[model samples]
Target: MSSADSSSSGFVLLGVEDVEDCALSNEGEGSLPLDRFGYVSDLVKKGNHAFRQSRLDMFEQAINYYTRANQIKPNDPIILGNRCATYLRISQFLKLRDSSDSEDRPLSGLDPTIHAELALKDAEKLGEIQSNTVRPFILKASALLLLEKYELARSTVISGLQVDPFSNSLQGALQHLEKMQAGNNGRRSHTKPERTDDFDCTLCLKLLYEPITTPCGHSFCRSCLFQSMDRGNKCPLCRTVLFISPRMSAVSVTLNSIIQKNFPEEYAERKAEHDGLTNFGADLMPLFVMDVVIPCQKYHLHIFEPRYRLMVRRIMEGSRRMGMVGIDPTTGSFAEFACEVEITECEPLPDGRFLIEVEGRRRFRIIRSRDQDGYRVAEVEWVRDLQLPDGSQERVDLLESTNNIAKHASSWLTRARQASQQDRSRYEKLLGLERMMPTPRDPERFSFWLATLTNRTPREKLDLLQLTNTRERISRALIYMRSGELGCRLDLNTITNAPPYTI
Candidate 1:
């Protein structure tokens, strides 16, 4: 017998649509091989059931069904991918429960780390299969992210995007990287400088932090001097030619003693970390001296505003730390997430305004912001990193769908490239068309596909920000790509109204 005929006896072929309603009416009635039809039908029904259960938040039941489906079709990529997604959901639920437990209470026997590791392994294995390979890559990236290997996770995502530029999951990964990088850079630039009361620099508005005493007995922040030198080598206060070395004078013994006495906790923490006295603690600390009152995300942001600027200046002058809070997009108000900043660079503008850079090292959530000593003071709570959901089959399906879209998109790109080579002027007329052409593992192209494919409406594009899961994002993008409504427009109006700029 032929291979197809031989295989027919071992497995069932069920219509994808019929499995959704859980009707097994055709199980024994058909002339086809009993084992094959029964198995495939049963597997499909289980998948449908799992999907329904997941939507209802009956995650445990969903996981069981997904597990069974995988057993029936052990090598099936879609089934494997879906199972991984279910596993991820279970992990998330367990972690949430653990977080709610009281510190005084004894821990449960279950270990979240073990579960996460197992799920990650399964994801990696499933990623190896040719039919469902992309699923593994996406899941592996997510697993790496949960494990706190940010750089590795970012690289994995970039690699996946290279294979499938239209993947929403890869796009999400790229965005996550950008946000993390931004937060890291922001934190490094915002370190607070030392304070001196002998001479107050008019530029930064306090007794000079990182005081560089000039020949004329004036002192300014080191950063302020460097910036001033770029325009004119004159002091803002006296317009004297300010000549100074790069190094700042050492912290006076008396001021250091006073800080050690007044802020014992802060002083000790800084000293231990800086002196390498503590092997386990982080190297840097947050900006402000505020007590934490709530839990927040990994990082907090402080926008450049007027009142907060003065608050930062005062904190740098004495404590060398200042509080930060993220602004809500809806109300333009502060969120619970906050951090402490250290002013590293404080520059004086010719107009007496200060240009400063601060670094954020730790995260906190704000309980309240109160006005103190003409500056805003926040009560915050320190937060630790939260665990992500485990691997799931839905995640696998999303990855598979993304790969399907990528295959189609790449084919389109190939065609476009061929067309471009044939007629350059014709290609030029199609604005946004060139973007569809493939690049050498470009992150920008991945982002472009994500925006073009999944976001049918402006509102939908805005909603993409809310989805945390990479797989879900990719699935949404696939739906858009199949709709056949993308990359069809070239806004000639903008092209016609352009300035004299030419390519």
Candidate 2:
């Protein structure tokens, strides 16, 4: 089998799409009795053949062949590497596949997450067997990236670089990690010094934004250094090979502060330029693509990724708002509808993560979307329920429906609280729901508030966000509340993943 770079440039698989060549000989296996080694070779050849096909089912077949080969030659680097690559490839395919398709014809065996976890195991074993080769580091790092363990992925790449300083793949992976930290926005500088070319980045010749001072005692804009490294893994000015990765290279705080204090006007201009990229316009907002949130929903989020950290910092400086969205599996993109949320509280942790409380305010439909730096940005149109005429029959009916649901919800809460007294988590959920109860006078907000009392899938919540009829929305909420009450009688875990109820 020929080993080359795969999609992420880390796996030691054959070709990107197909098997171009195979070296394992099966000449005598058909005609003669084969030994253990001969049989192992034959299995690997078959695995390679299947892997080269690049179809979802074929990838699974390749994994099966590799698994059999591994049984014959346990911990073999070749077998382990090939299998790891295959697992990652299949997981990627499944993740991008339409959700409806998977639901319609579900895989009978392992899911995407399981496949990625299995790949990580194989990568770890391969690393132990081939400690001196760059391939092990590549495979392990690739698996970690697929698993969304950003810090671990960076560490793996940094370690791989220690083994092979000139490895392009490792360097590329490190650069990718840095971009994940945030966009091109740089830190503010302080100090009093005569402004000159010294504050300028050699690459952009502009005032330094997020400046980094390399070990070689050279300073350059963080984005400039990484962009230069993209073409060649070396210092732009010097021929020195830099060892600094995202974890290792941090912005020069003192220098950054000096620049900010000395040139206030220029700094403000630069800030505006950067903000223009992250925050598009009055109707445009930066998007956090993770979960489905609805108006009146309040929750806490752990923001660790660099890009989001940067996005949060920018929001804190301005309107303190952003959009929360979930990917639509059918389109493999942002769902059409999302909720705008305001950051009610933001506590920046010592480790650069944010513990923030956000409350959903308004629902919006994405008119268009685009990639801004490493995250997503979009222009959206706000959504609101169509109001019923005052004193009309429909309005009166909605009020009656709301009151009935509210009474039912209250009775359910009382029982749930009594049952959950022995279970702190469930009790806490009930308490949260009680605190979020809205008066029946506002049937529209009341409907969304009612839905938060139960745990529903993102798809289900997205459906709620798209509803413009208060009565219909309240009816659906009543159904879910009733269902949860039933589920709780048998098992308490059916309550929202947390204490139940928050849109």
User: CA lDDT, every prediction?
Assistant: 0.44, 0.70
Model 1: runs farther than 4 Å from truth?
1-37, 55-57, 96-98, 101-107, 131-133, 185-503
Q: Can you write out model 2's per-residue Cα lDDT over 1-503, one digit (the tens) per residue?
A: 23233344222322123332344333432221244457567778888989988787788688777866664455667778888888777766654554355334543223344456667777888788788988778777766765556678889889988999988777776776776544323542233689899998888888988788875677887656644553444678886765433213446756776888788898888777766754557899889988999887877899877678667766765678999999887788789999999886554442345677788888999999888656788899989999889999988877886787688788877777787767855655565566567888889999899888877778788989999988767767766776665664323335435333322
User: What is the lDDT, from 0 to 100, of the residue 268 in candidate 2?
Assistant: 82
lDDT, residue 237, model 1 = 69
